[model samples]
Target: MHCRPCEPRHPDAQRGVALVVALLVFGLSAALLVAMQSEFTLFYQRGSNLFLAEQGHAYLRGAEELATLALVMDHDADQSREQPRDDLGEFWAQQATPYPLDEGGWLVGSLQDLQGRFNLNLLAATVTGTGEDGTDSARFTPAQAFFIRLLQALPELQLDSREAIALTQAIGDWLDPDTITRPFGAEDDFYSGQSPPYRAANRPMASASELRAVANVTPELYRALAPLVTVWPQTPAPLNIHTAALPLLRSINGDGELVPLSEMEAEALFQRQRSEGGFASLDALLEAPAFADKNMEGVRSLLGESSSWFLLTAEVEVADRNMRLYSVLHRDERTVRAVARASGSL
Candidate 1:
């Protein structure tokens, strides 16, 4: 069949439709490509973070193992003592050393003597149980009293006598097994009624930070108390003769009043000792009158002549990443025990 030719369409109009379609296709392709690229970037970042976290964890474990090996190899190497001079424990004994990571990063580890802290387990004990009833009447010894007093001195805290007494009782209750009441103790009844309703640890705290879980312990109080105390697997471990902070020595000498020296004075003394290769003997501390007057026998009983526990705080900086870890280690004859581990990163 014969047909007339169709009229030609407007050239500009036809070109305009084609151009609009092409533009739409191109816009959709660009949007998809952008979306895909964004998703890939997010995945890569997340994976990198996870890898870094894992690397930090591995380095922390490596530190712990190295400490353990030191304990195992040396008979006299105690966690409470300064990090021993052996190869394994030496890494932590020194300041943090950065280790390079696989992807332009680094990791670092550090070790610190836990003996520098007061043993919280000994808080309620006395020089002797030999008063009137063959039982210690006071909840805390003079040494412990001094320690608590130092804790009270922190400007951030405002604990009255009653609150202080309550805290002492709470800590004692948290450690002791039986529900029996000491004069100011808080038992299971006290904690079971709290917001979370938890049971007592009934054992010594694994970490100083555990104080937050005890009854009536406020975060402020915990913050105030944390720097001064530690929880080791055992009691009466030798206090770190070398690393004990000046505040602790002040507490030891203060006779519950913390009167012997100002904080600055105490720090200065400690710095002097550290500069002079640490204290040769605890007797040097007696040069201060407050410590001199103390019952020497009682002080000796409460504080040890050597160290047996350590807290190792380490930080690793790799490229743009930084990580921190806290580890509690206990040393026995030829063995190191890890009590706890915690980590964070930035």
Candidate 2:
């Protein structure tokens, strides 16, 4: 009495089960492989980016070294002016100096005369006049006057003479210490009237863009003036003569006697000076008929031929990536000091 034959198993069912298990295993392995590959690629990219960034940093350091060496070599080298001559009085006006980076990229470095821009810190010291009533007066200096006129020229800003003057005074007040009243000056009291109730800066601006905080200064005005002003870690003073813009030059010469030049004329003069190899002296500038009777002495006093501080902007490109580095250098006695360094990628 052997056991009866079990029902025959279905061939298709067995094959179907086998197929399902095989598919599940294959799918899991494939998913794992994809995940591993993705992680590996991410790691590789991270390493590559790190390497490029290191190279960029090295290039920037090299620039600093070169600038320092130049400063040391020339006892008479003046960083204040963006002269055509380098430390040894050699010309240095080209961009994109070659470097020894083996990664097949270029380092573009430029030394800008920080003196070209108005020292925001100086605004307080320069605006020194008492009103008829013994209060601080917001009269403009030659440079500030020029800056205001330039603001007026910008079609984007809709300010009139009174508003422009007020804005100028407000900026001065913002940088000054005392809260004493000036026609255009604003203090905590004045700002308290606004919805937000902010206080005046009462110190040098940390950045040129901060001008928007001053009373009567609109974004439009700030944008117009941004190109001409700068805030360094050091005290704000007169602009560098070698780097001063043409508008600044015209303003210095005109000294409230004549109207400021058009943008085109200003740019033309700037190009001419650059082409002719920076103004040898303020006299040469005054010799021009446009500046013949303009105030040359004041201009020279405000813009010196040498600079103690400078701003370096460098761009490094590797493969398809680009990085920009901004550094501030200060020459103290015989040493070159790096005040700050900022980097960005694109």
TM-score of each: 0.68, 0.72
Candidate 2, residues 213-300, lDDT tens digits: the string is 7887777667767766778745655565566765565445455532456666666667766776566765565676666655555445
Best model number under lDDT? 2
* Candidate 1 residue runs with Cα over 4 Å from true position: 1-52, 62-94, 97-102, 124-139, 153-155, 158-162, 254-272, 317-321, 333-339
In angstroms, the error of model 1 at 225 is 2.1
Off by over 4 Å in 2: 1-19, 73-102, 126-161, 177-181, 185-199, 216-220, 253-301
Pairs clashing within candidate 2: 79-307, 80-306, 80-307, 115-240
Among all candidates shown, the one with the greatest TM-score: 2
lDDT of each: 0.65, 0.66
What shift in Å separates residue 252 of candidate 2 from its native position after superposition?
Answer: 1.2
